[model samples]
Target chain A: MDIRKQFGANVRKHRQATGLSQEQFALQHDIDRTYVSGIERGKRNPTIVIVNKFAKALDVSIADLFDGCD
Target chain B: MDIRKQFGANVRKHRQATGLSQEQFALQHDIDRTYVSGIERGKRNPTIVIVNKFAKALDVSIADLFDGCD
Candidate 1:
């Protein structure tokens, strides 16, 4: 599968599930909104550190972001 | 937890389980041996693309590399 796109879709799913728009999620997570946008669109390739940050921000396991990706 | 360190350890564990040296693994994956070395040492910040490459090379899920990281 296309892991990046899957990851983006997963992130979007979780983020929306939390009732947080991209701007709110980015603000709460101290991430750039544009960066979050890029990530959610699968246009950004984030380092593991950033991935960890996303996992923490989303309150999900790193694996959760990769669900359906493998 | 130090996600990078945990990821490196997981990679090492999986790599060793496959009975392949870093050099061999790098060559087989078309990655730089030095980059692999850096990753195993927790000194590199690899993007998800590279992480996916490693997972594919090691025949593990991308989440497997971050197994204990979250």
Candidate 2:
């Protein structure tokens, strides 16, 4: 019910929809695989830097990433 | 020159333009002041959840936040 949980869930959905594994995503973004896992699990609070990397690597707009989370 | 630094600079610019301290902005968004500070300094990578909170707290579109960062 929390916003962060919703956001994380959305991220997981998108990542899976794109057919990219967490390791693949992290490698594309030059981040640790565990970091990507942590983010999907809501164990990490990524900064804007990480978000930008994700936006670029995932080929999604930041708006798209945050959409419907509200 | 990195996207993250640019994003952080934009964030700081917007925050200062609105005359908000990190604590005030974090309070408004129910985030930790230190977390907000970390974001401004490009030391943290906020998740989409945090970005949404920031977009709402700052009254700006997520697109606007990423607009010139690229």
lDDT of 2: 0.72
Native interface contacts kept by each candidate, as a fraction: 0.90, 0.56
Q: Ten-residue segment with the worst summed lDDT in candidate 1 chain B?
A: B1-10
- Per-residue lDDT of candidate 2, residues A1-70 (tens digit): 5555655676777888889898887787688989778777877767666666776777777666656655
As a TM-score, model 1 comes out at: 0.96
| Residues forming the 10-long window of minimal summed lDDT in candidate 2 chain B | B44-53
Q: Compute DockQ for each candidate against the true complex.
A: 0.88, 0.42
> How well does candidate 1 score on lDDT at residue A47?
91
Superposed Cα deviation of residue B24, candidate 1 (Å): 1.1
**Candidate 2, position A19, lDDT:** 91
User: DockQ score for model 2, please?
Assistant: 0.42
* Fnat of candidate 1: 0.90
